[model samples]
Target: MELAIILMILLIVVAAAAIKLSDVGLTFPFSKKTNLYTPAERKFLQMLDMAVGDQYRIICRVRLSDIVSIRPNTSVKVSRSAMAQAATKQLDFVLCQKDTMSPVVAVDLVSVEAERSYKAQRDWYVSGALDAARIPHIRIKAKASYKPQEIRDCIHAKLAPLRFQQPQEPLVRGTLNNDKAPLRRPVAA
Candidate 1:
């Protein structure tokens, strides 16, 4: 009983010392971020929201693994390798269908300097993976300002191939057809 009490006291002293040391500057090396996005990313997010918010849901900073999955019937080794590669990468933004929440497009913001550096290699891998998954990937240059219309046009161009035409004519209401007189209700006799 005496040995157990002594050991407990020693452990308590050690823990107290560790806590005091942490107060001196040895605490966990992390703090909450003040802002979720940088100024440029915030600006672009606004533009993207304005451009397509009505049609699709925009999600930011999504992991690639969340957007894609390993194909079936693959060897275990290859599957593990593919998953490992995707796990560390992230998409800047993902445009998902409003109703189904299916990912329609992945967008990345690239600076000129990044394109000239090692980031280009990362982009190549991302592009290849997106292509293999049949998801459209768009890269927009990071800029101080973006026009919503321009952003809309760029997205539309990339999605044009996925659009299907309707076979039937749209109904036109509240108008005379073939120059006929408008229908009038009969007056009470």
Candidate 2:
């Protein structure tokens, strides 16, 4: 019992010493004020907001995976690693429907940095993914200030065609044979 008590006292002394030493220079968590959007980005986002108005909601810094998915068909399978890779990429902004939250268009901010090889590759991947999903995207160059009308024009030019595209009607086998004939299944012998 004596040995146990002494050991406990020694452990307490050691812990107290460590704590005293840590007071000299141990790092503690600190919170600093930081703006989420840079000045140029903020200006562009404001322009986008004015252009979209109440028709669509502008979402910023959306992950690529959040907006896209691999549509698995009966004959095709997707690997987990592929999905993880896509999740790492992100978009500058996305325009979504206010009521349904459905993504309407993706918008990318283009700057001089985008001319670099790595940035160009990233841009290609983003555009290709959006194309595969049949989502419209607009790449606008970064500017000090943007006119709301110009942004509106750009969105209209890109999305109008997609919205008005004609949907293909499913083929009816019986209709090709005879217009008046009713659809009927084959009789068993």
Each candidate structure's TM-score, on Cα atoms with residue i matched to residue i, is 0.71, 0.69
Candidate 2 CA-lDDT value? 0.83
Error of 1 at 171 (Å): 12
Off by more than 4 A, model 2: 1-32, 73-77, 117-122, 167-189
Q: What is the C-alpha lDDT of each candidate?
A: 0.87, 0.83
Task: Give candidate 1 regions above 4 Å deviation.
Answer: 1-29, 113-122, 164-189
Residues 28-124, candidate 1, lDDT per residue (tens digit)?
Answer: 7889999999887899999999999689999999988898988889999998998899988899999999999999999988776664742444567
Which model scores highest in lDDT?
1
TM-score, structure 2 vs. true: 0.69
Residue 139 error, candidate 1, Å: 0.5
